[model samples]
Each structure stands twice: as C-alpha cells, then as structure tokens.
Target: MQDKIYFIELNEDKKYEDYKQYHSLLPLEKQQKIHKFRYDIDKKLSLIADLFIRFLICQNLKLNNKEITFEKNPFGKPYLLGNPEFHFNISHTRNAIAIGISGNPIGVDIEKIKCADLKIAKRFFSSNELEYILTNKEDSFFYEIWTKKEAYIKWDGRGLSIPLDSFDVTGGPIDKMLRMVTIHGYIISVCSRQDFNGAWCMELAEDSVPVCLQKIL
Candidate 1:
C-alpha cells in the first residue's frame, strides 16, 4: 500500500493515562469492549484500533472527538455516517495499528511474522493458491496470501460469511488492487478500488503533530 493507508505505532510503555484518555473518546460500547480484555496486549490493541480511527476521522474531517459518529452496515462493516463519501478500515497487530481511507471501499490488515499452520491453509486456500504457497517462500508466502485474503474479505465487508476457500489468492480481479508493505518485519496489505497510494508513516499516538514517519519500509 502506498498512500491511502495511514499507520500509527504506539509505545506500550507510554503513559497509560494517554491511552485511557483516547479510549474514553470512543463510544461507550467500544470502551466497554476494551475494558473487558483480560490481557494488556489485547486491551491496548483494541484501544489503539479505536484511537486510530478516531484520530484519522478527526484530522480529515476537522471534527472534534465527540463530533465523530459511526454506524456499521448490516454485515457489521463500520463506516462514517455523516460523510458517506469516505470509506475506511482498521487493523491491529500486537504492537502497531493501521487505518485506511479512500473515496471508495477499502480494507487493510497487518500480521506479525510468525509460525505457520499449513494445515489451516490447506483447508482454506484453493488448490492453485496452495500450490503457490507450497512451492514458494513458505512462511512468507503463506502470510502474503493470508494478509491478502484478509484484506479482500474486509473489503468485501461480509466478514467470514464468505468462504475463504472459494476465492483464488494467487491472483484475481481482487488481487489487482491489493498491495503489500513490509514494515518492522510485519506484513501489511491493503485493498482499494483504485491503485493504492497509502501514506505510511510512524505516527505515534502521543505525537500531537502529524509528520511523515521515517524508518518504515
């Protein structure tokens, strides 16, 4: 992804109060969800995901935190209510968060580099998709397809109701619009109607001012 997906990396050691403040800005339902996570990582990830969406919306629409409103589609796809022209999606890994926005529907995903369960892939990936994964870079290949499939489903907005095995991950009309970026050793993928020109930068949640984030690749 080149310019539409904006990223924010948060320091877990940063003041908890700041995160709490941002979490409070979210709707009561989201704040409750964040509060229910038993593990610190889960809680932070949830909070940051909400914060990323709120921060991006506030910045782009020039609105206050309270002014932002969201409503999910019948399929559970959340969207900007007041401004339907803008489309967005949010994703988070254990350490970082990503948000994408565009004039058309969009989806994004970030997965930390890790172990493989080829068995799961075997069940979910098509024969051709599995062929591509088994013959290529192994784990990297698996994640490449994994992230792409994830972004595609998010873009589709039907969630897991769409059978993952039904789509070809190797390449297709959907893959044409997808792009990937490797940052901090994680695989980041995005889907959009047009060519992706996502703005990727390391904007820390605490940084008050928005600046181009370097050291992200």
Candidate 2:
C-alpha cells in the first residue's frame, strides 16, 4: 500500500484575477459555494484552499468527481464514504494546507504562528511541557510545541474537546502510536493505526496556484 503525505502552501493574498482563474477551474458546486460567499474573503480563501486539495487528490488518484463523497464525523472530522481501504486527513492554516494519505488511518494539522501568548499554554500543555517551554525562552519554539499537541489531538478524532494536557509527546521517532515534530515554523504531528517509522515528508511551495479537483479514495 502507498503511504504518502503531501503538503501544499498557498499565499492567501491572491489577486482578483488569480482568484478568477482559479475559480473558473473549480467544480460547479464549489463555484456556487464560492459565489455564495463573495463578500466574505476569509470564507472564500478557505473554499479555494479546499478545492485545491481536492484537485490534487483527484489528479493523484485518477478518480472522477462523481465518485467522491464526503461525510463528517459527529465531531465534524471529514472522511470518505464507501471507501475504507484508503485513509486521509487534512489541515490548513491561514497560509498553508496539508494532506496526509496512507493505507493506515492518519491525521494532519497546520497552524500559522501569530501573536498568541505563551501564558495560555498551561491550559493545554502538561506541567512538564510548560516547564520545558519556560526553560526554552522562545516564543516560536513554544508555538511549535502547541501546534504539535493540537495536531495530535485532532488526529485522535476527539478534537480539542479532549483535555489538551492529557498526554505528552517526547521528541523522538514516532512509534506505533503518536509522534510530533517541528517543521519550518510549523508544528506537525501525526497519529496512525500503526507505527510510522521512517516516514518522509514533502513540502510544497507556498505560492503554488490552486487547481480544481476532488477525489473519492
């Protein structure tokens, strides 16, 4: 089975012309959704990003648009319908998008580093994690830690509804359970059905243009 994950980044500040070109390629339903939110730029950008990911998935899997069906968990985690052989997860930050695809269940998350204060880390991070962050004295490092934890929680399919401090991730090769890593100003974490030893990552360019597409598996 193929075990590959793709990371795509896009500048959220695309010009109207760029958006028009991207929008024209989107599926009809997606186009309607975009038009419906014409006045909401944030919602428009998010739709565009999602369309891009769908496009990539379609191209890679060679699947037709009609074959894809999306169903969300009770907690709102999106999943494929009628296809259980392949597993995937998606996460997008303000300026980037990430997609994790594998034969085993997988989850991915991306977050943009902003001005969030470390004071709130106590609410989510364990006491040991808080102490480590304090000793590090780096806001960027702290964000990395925060994102990793958040990603793991999402991967668990419980969302932030689960207490954030319930678990700790020691830096190491991710085993059969949970693993965390800091990559390029982003905290990335993955949870899988089995150990993810020797997994490699591909980072796409941030300014890559969006493509129109969708996939079922």
Candidate 3:
C-alpha cells in the first residue's frame, strides 16, 4: 500500500463528553496513560494520536479494534503486534495530531510554526542544517528541517539512540525520501522508502475520522 498521512486540528473547547467518547475507544492501558496527564490538552493529544492510528489500521485490515495489539522494536518504535510488516508512526504538536501508515516502514512529525530557536537548532542540527536554516530568512525553514530530521530518525526506528547531529538532512539521500507540507500554521514531514510522489497528506476534521475509513474500505 502507498504511504498515507492524516492529521487533525483539535478544538481546544471540545466537549468533555466528546473526549470521553473517544477516550473509551482506546485500550485500557492507553486510557490509563491518558488519564495520568495533568492537563486536558495533554490528554487530548495523547488520546487522538493513539486513536487516529488504531482506527486507521483497524479499518485497513478489517479487524476489530479491540483485537489489534502493538509491540515495540528493540529501539522502542511501535508496530502492530501480529502484522509485523505493516509500519506506522504518530506525532502531535500542541493542537494538531498526525499519523503515517504504510506497508513499509514510515515516520511522521508535525510541529506548530513558531519563532525559530537558534540555540536549540545549534545543539541538535548538523552544521549543514544549521547553515541552511540560517541562510533562509523565513522561520518555516527551521521547522521544515527540524521535522525532516525528526521524521528521518523515526523512519530509521533507532530513535534518539542515534544522534540528531550525526547526519545531514539538507541535501543528502535522506532528503530524497522526505515529503513535507505546511497547513494552518503547522509544518508536517513524512519519511518513507517509497518515492515522494503522490503520497497523500490530508487534513482531517475532528468529526471526519470515519470518512477516511469509508474511503479506504
């Protein structure tokens, strides 16, 4: 299957009843983790990111959501329990959540656009990446590079065990596998072995989760 990406822009004032409805769909373990968060936004972000991927996989495979299970790699990247070949990654930033799923390994990240922090950039980014961000006048460049780097590491599935600054993403083989899009003041990056062409990066309404299920079915 082709790599698919989906994101939701959250409503800060969504009803508590709505939260409970979605929260109920998650596994008891995940629901407990969400309940542990002190703030509602934290709980919401955690809930949506987990549920977004779970429902998508369930729809794609035509399986019961409750039957699906997940296991982590040695590096701590999560994968479907029985369907080891299917790969997915989830990320959220503040008020938005994004998930990527593919027949092959995939990684995705979303970040709200904000003022670029050169200090963090200098610490985490490679020299070439730093120069690329500094050369570009727009703040979006920082997030563009930042998200790409994040997506790459997640795609690699080694997580932070691999150093962020050890590799350059500005213009290397890794750049070829990355696809990026910005929507509603947020930047998203997706990485996969597949060619970048024709991959869908779609914005989903809060109530429209089932729309994708119908289409995929």
Residue-by-residue lDDT tens digits, candidate 3, 64-164:
77777888999999999988767899999898998988888898999999998889899999999999988986899999998999999999999889899
In the range 1-217, model 1's lDDT, one tens digit per residue, is 1247766666767644455534556778988877788877778777667666676676677667777788998889899888977799988887777778877888888887788789989999989988898888558788888888999999999978899999885777877978888777778888877665434434445353123111110
What is the TM-score ranking, best to worst? 3, 1, 2
Task: Superpose all Cα atoms of candidate 3 onto the true structure and report the RMSD in Å to 1 decimal.
Answer: 2.5
Give the best candidate by TM-score: 3
TM-score-better candidate, 2 vs 3: 3
Residue pairs with backbone overlap in model 3: none
- Which sections of candidate 2 miss by over 4 Å? 16-41, 114-116, 171-184, 193-199, 206-217
TM-score of each model, in listed order: 0.87, 0.75, 0.92
Query: Candidate 2's C-alpha lDDT?
Result: 0.63
The residue pairs found clashing in candidate 1 are 2-197, 2-198, 3-197, 3-198, 3-199, 4-197, 4-198
Across residues 1-217, which tens digit of lDDT does each residue of candidate 2 receive?
4565566655545543455544544557767776675555455456656665556556656666456677778877777677676677787665566677777667776666666577788777778778888888877657766766766666677787778777775444333355555566665666666556575566766454432331222
Candidate 1 accuracy as TM-score: 0.87
Error of 3 at 177 (Å): 0.9
Off by over 4 Å in 3: 210-217
